[model samples]
Target: MAVKKIGIIMNGVTGRMGTNQHLVRSIVAIRQQGGVVLSNGDLIMPDPILVGRNEDKLQALAEKHGIERWSTNLEQCLADPHNVIYFDSQTTVRRAEAIRKAIKAGKHIYCEKPTATSLEESLELAQLAYEAGVKTGVVQDKLFLPGLLKLKRLIDSGFFGKILSVRMEFGYWVFEGDWQAGQRPSWNYRKEDGGGIIVDMFAHWRYVLDNLFGNVKSVSCLGVTHIPKRLDEQGHPYACTADDAAYATFELEGDIVVQANSSWAVRVNREDLLTIQVDGTEGSAVAGLRDCKVQHRVNTPKPVWNPDIENPFNFSEQWQTVPDNQNFDNGFKVQWELFLKHVVTDEPFIWNLLEGAKGTQLAELAIQSWDERRWIAVPELSLGVKQSDAVEASK
Candidate 1:
């Protein structure tokens, strides 16, 4: 019967993903739904203040969303006791500094990945948050995707009995700014700006492999920059220093082998921008962003090798589509709601800062593997700062 309003400082929301996914599709949509309903008939409404560098952009975004608060000064917003949560969608290079400030201000944290460009800094943030005793959550939105949800269902039902391997294909060709404007920001191709497909996509892959199939045991990755030069936002050509593509193979705890090819410089010729095909002993399934199709061992078609003539079997038509069993909300919004509940009543939220750090760790190792052209072992992470260490941090 009671409505509780919580304040959130949404930083770097003027960016593309920040504006569309986190702001419009998530926060704005949540407000439109009359806020997140908590158990015991209570409602939790988010009062978000959009914070960015540009005043005009922030003001325009706020006005468009029917929000009254927008701030150019993040410190000023962080100092306010009303704003209890800090959400960052800033560039990889800028995220840690802002998060450190927010943690110092004693605000709960939620943000997009990779949390830091390096594993050391990521671990430090996780440890700091633990010492501060602040509730934290990271964006593991892919796990909540409808297609992945169906894939999870299949895994749980023994449909893929004794799962073996997974093949993930993810990419879309980003236009160079010569004839057409690039789809992504220019910073995405600059190594100095914390940009690379390995760093970016390995973050997502780590949790997906860990949570769904098993914890990653080892990784062998190869990364490259396909496009040497690309036009920046202002049509100025700049040399690309970061890896635009990554081909990675992972060994999971249950002996599951996962192969992922992530790229920004390749053309798509698939059902979705991202698709994962899971093959197991009993059955196999292919899942995209919204759809999953499966073929059981009994139903799978076998064809004799005849490359001389056209194949007789309708390979694509063999699989059956997975039905949408229930209404699915936006993945980002769903995670946001869970974090809100966690902040409110200590709900069991698992995707904390350490999980985010794990993503960064995977990315770091992937890059290292690519550089060395060798398989790297992934050690289990159990991070906590001692009371004395926390005291030292204070001094």
Candidate 2:
């Protein structure tokens, strides 16, 4: 069996999500597992060069991971022909320019979500990559979560026949950093830095809804900045100009309604930090980050309405737990492996730049809907190259 080495220039991986999810849990773990095995018994090994603005942090991260390649010069790394792929996890405001540079350097691109702050710029990047004939992808990691996987299985098995509506409650209280440090980066609360829950999370909801339920037809949203001020990493106070919470309603292709409440100021009182409840004709399911519970029509308890008498039904006990029958890997790692395979073996990868642009479009419309206080119609995006055709063209 032969082994192939693929050099990846990993940019902005020193940040929290970049370091923990993409680098440590995904790429580094793949390296530790002897790389990805191909169908023909060949091995595709990843050689990552850590790139960031800070030399000391990049060097330390590289050394900690037993990696030898570390660079502070992004242009130099992009100029290197050996590095065929450029991966970015930079701040949202900085991603477009960096990705444009990488595309100009003739590198395949992969990166974290909300590819750009606006739909126009996102589509521009997608068009540029398509014209450049480079393999491109954007992160849609939530679809691979174990809980969502089980939900998909249920949907495929007809457990929730003729699904009607979906309710998603996703959020956790992020400290304002006056007394305690905030869990997320300070930039996440600043609009000038491309920060907002709608921009950050509505992109996720768009793909999740489109993939699992149906195409979104329209949207109505309300955005809020619950916390007016917060302390930054340097313990200095700053005004919070971005929306920390979003309450959005969506209408799907099949008349299925979806209501999602995403917030950073809400306390967690549910089974997990995130929970999705789907109600259908035959049954209903509530899936958290890791566990799923279901209540079928046959097993659902019936209770009589009595205002004067004591209620005796145990609401939470009626649902049955979904068993863990299969082993699940980290979501980020799974996508990383797929992307690596797509790059080397010309495998089909559906989550390309166009899909990323679609997500950006959803967020853009949602914000507009909120600002206008009216429903916004979601139009189908027309890409120059169909995604499936692009895959065929690559082959």
Candidate 3:
């Protein structure tokens, strides 16, 4: 059988994630590997057209990747019947509008998380996609991280029986892009541009919690603007209008509590970029970005303290390193492969637009909780008539 060329209209291809992950690592890598081989022995080839607002940047990216198709006009590409997929890595503020345009053009959609600037807009996108009968997905990439996968396996095997509580610490001191050349975009520090630590990281936490531990029921959070001023893309000063750090606590349905700290102003002095500590009645484990270690009841330590003497609790020494049992691809690349497969084979990909809306709801609620100084309960996400019913009825 010949290859089925799936035309993908890739908006925001000139940006950070677009250039590095989607274009170079996924699409180009697939092309180099002779496309994606299906179970039927045929292949699904991705023909990506770089679309963005910057003509020069798009042209430069197209030339760099040997892509013949490049355009600044999104609607023009959307009108082309051959382009069946609309992919986006644009800013959060721009996603809903772009996606609505694509849905109007009758194209399947895939994009980054926090699908819109607000939860309402995110849910609207999900409903619109469902109404248009278009397949949609959002990036939920952390599930593919090797260490996290290992932790998942442990949880599945009941290594930590009767889970108690979980703690997570994730952050790095992101240098101001202007003076020190930061690792993140400058707009990430501005509220007008949909930038904040809580909005960005809590979206990730929502999925990670649901996928790994349990469903989040309620949340209490306090967001802070630790850095009042920062440098921009250019070597100039700008007042930061968004939160730099967030300390949040989530209560799961089954009496599980999760506390997470996300920040951009903190100096790194931790196990990894992200570390999750899980404790259960039987055992305890800590998983980092690339490593996980566990402590069992058999190896539990004991210590004592006296009023006249200093206490010694060397419990950290009792934990043993969990061995790596499998290899995993890059997180973004793994999700990209699944998205491609879903596009070609019509596989059930649950991380769709509705799931993205749930994450957005969590982020928005976290902000509301911060503002109101009260706990917020996340309302259930509804995608018009139930998605399963829509799919079966269509079939």
Candidate 4:
């Protein structure tokens, strides 16, 4: 029954993802639940100090959440020794600089991914954090999702024997802001702001594929800026310089192939905004954000090719829905809880800055592959190596 209050400096939390996922759903929800209980009966409570550029927004967020601490000055917050952890959810271009500053200030770092814009900077950050001996983590939220968790369970249970290939369909039509405002931030379509679907999504895909199926050996990608002209938040029209859509293929360690189509321009026709279908020798499963359906080889119906005759087979009826035997918490909250435990007790946290660097590497290579019109080999990243050494090793 010992309660330990961990002061966390939450920067850039005024943003949508930072506000909703990191602050409200995760940290605040954890506080509401009376903090995270350790195995040794100690309670780890997160005392978050909301930090942002705007004083009014920070004050409002703090007041709304009933939080005691709020600050517009990041350096002032970092200077305090009581704040042991620094969490960033800022724009991609700004992440590395802020994280570096935090690390220098002797704070454990946790933030959203594509940790940096380039492979070199990401690796450098990882190395710096490692040398500093401070705990670091990146948000791999999708791995904790109910559907993906169930899929992982199925994989573990040998439900899909001799796993073969994975196909992911993820997208939604984002309004152009002419008539209706875009669902995403205006910076998401601007290349100068480190915005693009390829960089944003490939970070998630790299971890998902590596953790779920196998290590990605190589990648081939095609990127497109489908919506060139889009209105900004101010209803002013601007030209989009970043890729809004991406069609990518990956080869895994087990020779398993993965095809992912990511776009903000495509309309949703599937089960959810994201759906991953895995086909294997013994069975197949299609998992959305919350639901998962599976079809074993024995249950799969045979359908012959017929160009002239009308198809009569009930294709959708053959699959069985995977039951929700266990109650699932919010994915972001789940990770946040784990991270809290890691911060308090010396718990094993595998998703470190090195892993985040690997994710950034994948995105960088995918973009290179698309630009060069060739398959890019995904080399293993080492935290111990220097930038030059790592570059040489990749060749």
Please tell me which predicted candidate would have the highest TM-score against the true structure. Answer: 4
**Best lDDT among the predictions, by candidate number:** 4
**Residue 97 shift from truth in candidate 4, angstroms:** 1.0
Reference-based TM-score of each model: 0.97, 0.96, 0.93, 0.98
Flag the better candidate by lDDT, 1 or 4: 4
Name the lDDT of candidate 1.
0.92
Candidate 2: list runs displaced more than 4 Å. Answer: 385-395
TM-score of 2: 0.96
Of candidate 2, the 10-residue stretch with the lowest lDDT total is 386-395
Clashing pairs in 3: none
**C-alpha-based local distance difference test score of model 3:** 0.87
lDDT of each: 0.92, 0.92, 0.87, 0.93
Q: Across residues 1-395, which tens digit of lDDT does each residue of candidate 4 receive?
A: 89999999999899999999999999999999999999989899999999989999999999999899999889999999999999999998999999999999999999999899988899899999999999998999999999999999999999988989999999999999998989999999999999999999999999999999999999999999999999999999999999999999999998899999999999988889999999999999999999999999999888999989898888888899999999999999999888888888879889999999888888888898998999989899987778877755543
lDDT of 1 at 50: 99
Two-way TM-score contest, 1 vs 4, winner:
4
